[model samples]
Target chain A: AQRVTQPEKLLSVFKGAPVELKCNYSYSGSPELFWYVQYSRQRLQLLLRHISRESIKGFTADLNKGETSFHLKKPFAQEEDSAMYYCALDIQGAQKLVFGQGTRLTINP
Target chain B: EAGVTQSPTHLIKTRGQQATLRCSPISGHTSVYWYQQALGLGLQFLLWYDEGEERNRGNFPPRFSGRQFPNYSSELNVNALELEDSALYLCASSLAKRVRGQPQHFGDGTRLSIL
Candidate 1:
């Protein structure tokens, strides 16, 4: 069974500080990883995908097959970056997502 | 292009009652997905429909069922709702083609509260 785990239930950081949201997965097959964020009063939206290898909104996540991790990272966190971050794993070709418990990110001014 | 839309922003029902949630995909999207975001449970895949067929479903019970219409809209019906069933039901849409991974666009979600 494919499973995603986001270790932190909540993470707080001051503005301009670096942010890293940890994510780990347990899947036998090669997995597709993604980061989704939901801002206050906003719907959940895609943050970044490992396959794309492109950064979005200053965030990037690299899929580490060896370690079975895909941690989302940002060099400089902004106040607006406060949101709930979810790490998801796509179940092979089925494209069904298995999401983590989610990490609530709060950036203090 | 309009994003995915879900009906009844909030729904309240008592135990043993039935709850029906609706979702309308993007204008040209042919795939619709349902996910349940319960407190601490995160987002659990519920159902996936494409081309009016049920493609995939999570480990939910038989009481949780849904169908996609020919026009690509879908409805999720929860039979005999229980208090534990209370959660935010989210609807998302993406292109059916698998060649390139199209990110699933999610809606605001329906807040289903079972009393």
Candidate 2:
């Protein structure tokens, strides 16, 4: 069974501070990871994917197969970065996503 | 292009009743996926349809079923709904081709309340 776990249910940080949303997964096979974010009134959108290895919106996540973790990180947080962040794992080639409990990120002004 | 769209932004039903949620994928997309966003469960994949066929489904009961139309739109039918069934249902779409690893685009979701 593939599982995604986001340890923090809520994370708060001041603007310009570094942000790291922790994510851990339990999967026996090779994994594909993705970070999805949902703003106040916006739909859930893709933030970044490990397969692409490209950063989006100043956020990046590296797949650590040894540790089974794919933590989303940003050098400096912004007020507009406040949103609900979800870490998802793709189940092999099935295109199914197993999501974490999600971390609500709040950047204070 | 328009993003994935879900109909009936909000739905209210009583226990034992049935709830049907609709999803229209983005244009040119051939795959549609359904997910349930309960209070604490986060997002659980419910169903996946491609090319008018049910490709995959989550651990949900048989009461949770859905189908994709020829046009690539989809409908999720929940039978004999229970209070625990109340949650926000989200729809997403992506290209069926697996080579590209296309990201799934999501909709605003429909809030279903079971009384």
| TM-score for each predicted model, relative to the true structure | 0.97, 0.97
Residues B21-105, model 2: lDDT tens digits: 9999999999999999998678999998999999989889999998999999999999999999999999999987544345888
DockQ of each: 0.70, 0.70
lDDT by residue for model 1 over B1-115, one digit each (tens)? Answer: 8889999999999999999999999998899999999987789999989999988899899999999999999999999999999999999998876443458889999999988
Error of 2 at B74 (Å): 0.5
> How far does residue B114 in candidate 2 sit from its true spot (Å)?
0.8
Each candidate: RMSD: 1.1, 1.1
lDDT string for model 2 (A3-66, tens) is: 9999999999999999999999999988888999999999999999899999999999999999
For residue B101, model 1's alpha carbon misses the true position, in angstroms, by 3.4
Cα-lDDT of candidate 2: 0.93
